[model samples]
Target: MGGPSGASGTAAAPERRSGLNRVSQQRAEAEERQRIAEGRHSDPFAYLGGPHGPSRRVRIYHPEAAAVAFSEGTEVPRVAGTDFFEAPLPEALEAPYQVCWRDAGGAWHTAYDPYAFPPVLSEFDLHLYAEGRHWHAQRFLGAHCTTVDGVAGVVFSVWAPNAERVSVVGDFNRWDGRRHPMRLRLEAGVWELFIPGVEPGALYKFELRGAGGCGPLLKTDPCGRRYQHRPETAAVVEPPEAYPWGDDAWMERRRREGSAWQQAPWSIYEVHLGSWQRDVGGGFLDYRTLAHELVDYVQRTGFTHIELLPITEHPLDDSWGYQATGYFAPTSRFGEPDAFRYFVDYCHRHGIGVILDWVPAHFPRDAWALARFDGTPLYEHADPRQGEHRDWGTLIFNFGRNEVRSFLLSSALYWLEAYHLDGLRVDAVASMLYLNYSREDGDWVPNIHGGNENLEAIAFLREVNTVTHGEQPGTCIIAEESTSWPQVTRPTYLGGLGFTMKWNMGWMHDTLTYLGEDPVHRRYHHDQLTFGLLYAFTENFVLPFSHDEVVHGKGSLLDRMPGDDWQRLANLRLLYAYQFTYPGKKLLFMGCEIGQRSEWDADATVDWAALSDPRHAGVQRLVSDLNALYRGVPALHRYDFAEAGFAWVDCHDAEQSVLSYLRRGDAGEQALVVLNFTPVPRHGHRLGVPAPGRWTERMNTDSAYYGGSDLGNAGGVLAEPVPWSGYPYSVTLTLPPLAGLVLVGEGA
Candidate 1:
């Protein structure tokens, strides 16, 4: 029998539901339609899809149709004045079927019903996520397009465990939460839904309802791989398979290194993407343009790697990407996610490694973001003392929570695995280590053991290192830790943070301060230059002169010098020689190479105009030469973090403001380094040598080619038999004023 049609219907299908059974099913169908219309259905899918019973009775709730029918089943009954429609089918729904519908204006439309598909997330996925060990959550818990039952749509999922209800609101559905509510996976605290007809480039956010007094909270997806451009903070749908990479050689080299970057001569050029370069119109350059421009610049500059300042998605340009919101999404300030991947791939293909500054210590308190997520402090602690960063007015992650721990760990692995990045430079680790960081008395809390250490964050750091180092063999994890945290670079089994390297913050401060003093007054502060050696080999260190030294009114590296034009340039040149020849790795911020005279500006580009000046150009040239020397000369880099690499020859030469040192490699090569701080040259200075041989001057900071006065040794010095300064032999040579020199022993 044919089913009823509109207001004039024939008898129902053969042996159809009748009497009390018919009335009961009608009531249940009416209730299901009401729930769908109210956007509060607990199990909408249980009643909306085909083949509901033994008689193959099917049902569907299209809240916008005046008349409807299926291609294979009987004409569905309208079930009174509501959108509730039903019919009886002869077979089960094995494949996708189109729904023919007519609107109030009498226009026909068709679409695949979303409920016909099965659940996408697997049980194993739910178990791993519940255990807080899902290191690749982004692969499963975000909007991704796929085919289900021969139908294409986007699968939207998010973690909102405390929400009474959750829905995906986007442009395709009029941004109305009343249209589509997601299914809740109770164990994993995740909500998911597959919506038909949603395509790429669609903008969306999660609208969550909780029991709290606050209204529905619309949040940007924490695991979104791509995002819409700023001034609009919505998650944009993009496919991860969009970008194809070509850097297998570089990746294989890293696989060979396997956490042994301590002696790899990593001379990193630190840059902020928004200000590294600007277009002719004064706007930010796209990542593709930067891929060409920056790769050429870094390769010619001889830097082994480039470390970007937090290119993750951020709202304010002033934060310099430190206050990032989208952990999985790259910053849209430059280009799309795929373009940024291309930038990294280009660098790798050209033999340049890429490292990103990752910030997990804090997040901004923006209303539309992670703060009060799900109408509560879902990602942060409820207490201000534990959750808030007082100085920045941002929220701190509650690392004690299992889900929060999993989210952060997943983000770390996602970058290395998905983007093919070389490493992560973790920012503000000191802040995350101590509870009293940037806090006044009585404004903080102690840990479970009544100590000021952040135990939970410490555990999280150790776990992150253990997981990343164990999983990604060749990749490195660096910490910007300022305090005397022991074993920071040691393995996790030895009760350490398990980082590969730690920034030598003390060396940066002391060395820069010593170099800024007047030559006449440098004798009194000679310890500033020698104190760093007291703990130089404590951890695998990266001697950094990063952006911190040149911003917020501290002035540029050039401005920090205290001398006339010639003296200042020479002093700056000598500083570079000291940093490169010293035991440890190296990192220099952008614009410092060209002798930028002012502090760093996040809004403006680097001082490319400064290169027109010969003095500035000379500084840039010297830095490039230093990089080449650092990598080529094993004595300058190998065994950098071991006691066998360095020795002080003349630390007590305070009267002349002079210093001498020896740098050695594992293969027994030797390089002698000497620095003269005063403006007066030392003629016929007797220097002790450990071996009786001729030593050639390898580099001289006072050479005329580097914009200096051209003072140097004639070419090489011969060691005589006379014993002096604790060595078996001595040599007499002229030491240039306000300059540095490196000498390699014969046969080295």
Candidate 2:
């Protein structure tokens, strides 16, 4: 009787413990559902959907639905206190089962549960990304419309290592962050999710919840291939379609002539696409229209290449695409990515190379863009000294970070590979090279070696140049470097930054200053024009009259000349003639060719009406002839970077305000250039000739064809055997007022 009582008590104790365990499990489930409802659940996939427990029950969460069920007509029972419904796994349901829900409007919609799919990113991809060696990071990071396990959907990925939860939110899900939370890849800092039924053209952004009470940061895709037009920061899903390239011949030719661009003639027409021309309504023209119009204009002008001022996607029109927001996406202000492709393709087909002004120096501090992404300084450095450009009010990229390098490098290659651009002219390189650029002594942080040089940025530059050139042969990477940075255009293997060319800022400044002086005082400042030759061949240089020269209260090139109207036009012609004959490649802004009277305004088109004036038309014609001559003559362009190509015939004639030089080609071809800086004519000027022959006027800036006074050497001049100015022969010829001459020898 006693033993039976003891056994009953023990059984009662076991029953009580089981009851408590059931209550604890129920409470934990309730808490988990609460986190999911609040959008704070880090791993919603573990408990939200899929077969769980011995009963194989499937759970679904739909905040906007009135009722939920499986596609096979299996009704799911809603939990009493939550927006979740649960039902046992259906036998007839497929692997990616569909969940049908009735909305509050009594409309039924069926969608494949986004959380049902497995991880879309491969292990190798994660490994490479974490190691920061993902050269093609774009192939894995952006929203790609692809087929995963025979199910059509978009695989969205982003690098947000500090995020506790990241979601793919857009208008499809009512912009709710809780609708489709992504699964985090622990190995790498990337988050990825495959959302079925999401198609191309869907607008999306990453909604992130950071740790330590940071934020619910909503950010545009960093690697977005296409974004919506400005004033709206959402990224659009671009279809994964390869552009039909028709530049096979161009590509092959570029590859065959790799690194030979130095010897080639580069008469670049630097154009600001937005202001180069506009629609009749004064609005922006689509890329397709620009393709036909701009290409035709550049071709007719005889420019070998067109250097476009930054067309990368940016928000503010005032930034002129320099403060870039999207690196991979072409600015939608024109057209879709495919349309920009048409523009480049059209250019190449017409034998015109296109170079884009690429800005990797700094980025704008837009909230939806890269600034403080993941509620932390992810893409930029946290320290203000190293991370910020105070003058620009922009953030500098942390080149010291490996992932940042991957991002920037991938961006560079994407343009070359996807758009088939001829090259990139990197903007504001001086700022990137110096740690104290635009900074006070106490405001900037020095390097570990207490130096002003930014070693990390230097390394990044070298790496980018090496990677881009190695990947895309014949891609001419130029630097707009203003300072005396050494070896910017040399090979990286030789401890150089490895750019193809650099803009000659010193030449531009010195020549402009000299030309701005009056003729009466020109002899006192003659050295300004001759001083550039001292270091002219230090690097492969591009003589640029860029947009910088025609903006910010600095009037047009024509306005720089100090003379009467007639002499001003002649001086403008002389300027172009000097630039073409100079030992460098050429880059002239769009309006400069026609002698634009007003400064460059990004909001306005080039003053096409100026072309109606004969004086302006004359300048334009002179430019075209200069391009033709620069390309046709070997002596003028072949050895532009070699010391053997140029010789001072009579640089000592400063008292007469006259200068002369001899340009020599490798094959003994020769051209003599002589300029009279003053407005007075220098007739009977005994200029020394390199050879004893007839020197014909190839280009006379004072010719009547160029709005000049028709004062120059009559058709040709014969050099006598009289040694003068340390030459074997001499020619006495008429030098025009405020003009220059290009005299070619008969044998040349």
- The residue-level lDDT of candidate 1 at 248 comes to 88
lDDT by candidate, in order shown: 0.85, 0.90
Give one digit per residue, the lDDT tens place, for model 2 in 37-152.
88888888888777777777788888998999898899988998779898887988755788899999999999887766778899898887776677789999989998877889
How far in Å is the alpha carbon of 600 misplaced in model 1? 1.0
Lowest-sum lDDT 10-residue window in model 2: 126-135
| Alpha carbon deviation, residue 658, candidate 2 (Å) | 1.4
TM-score of 2: 0.98
Off by over 4 Å in 2: none
Task: Give candidate 1 regions above 4 Å deviation.
Answer: 1-35, 46-66, 73-97, 103-106, 240-242
Question: What pairs collide in candidate 2?
Answer: none
lDDT per residue, candidate 1, 360-392, as tens digits? 999998877888888888889898888999888
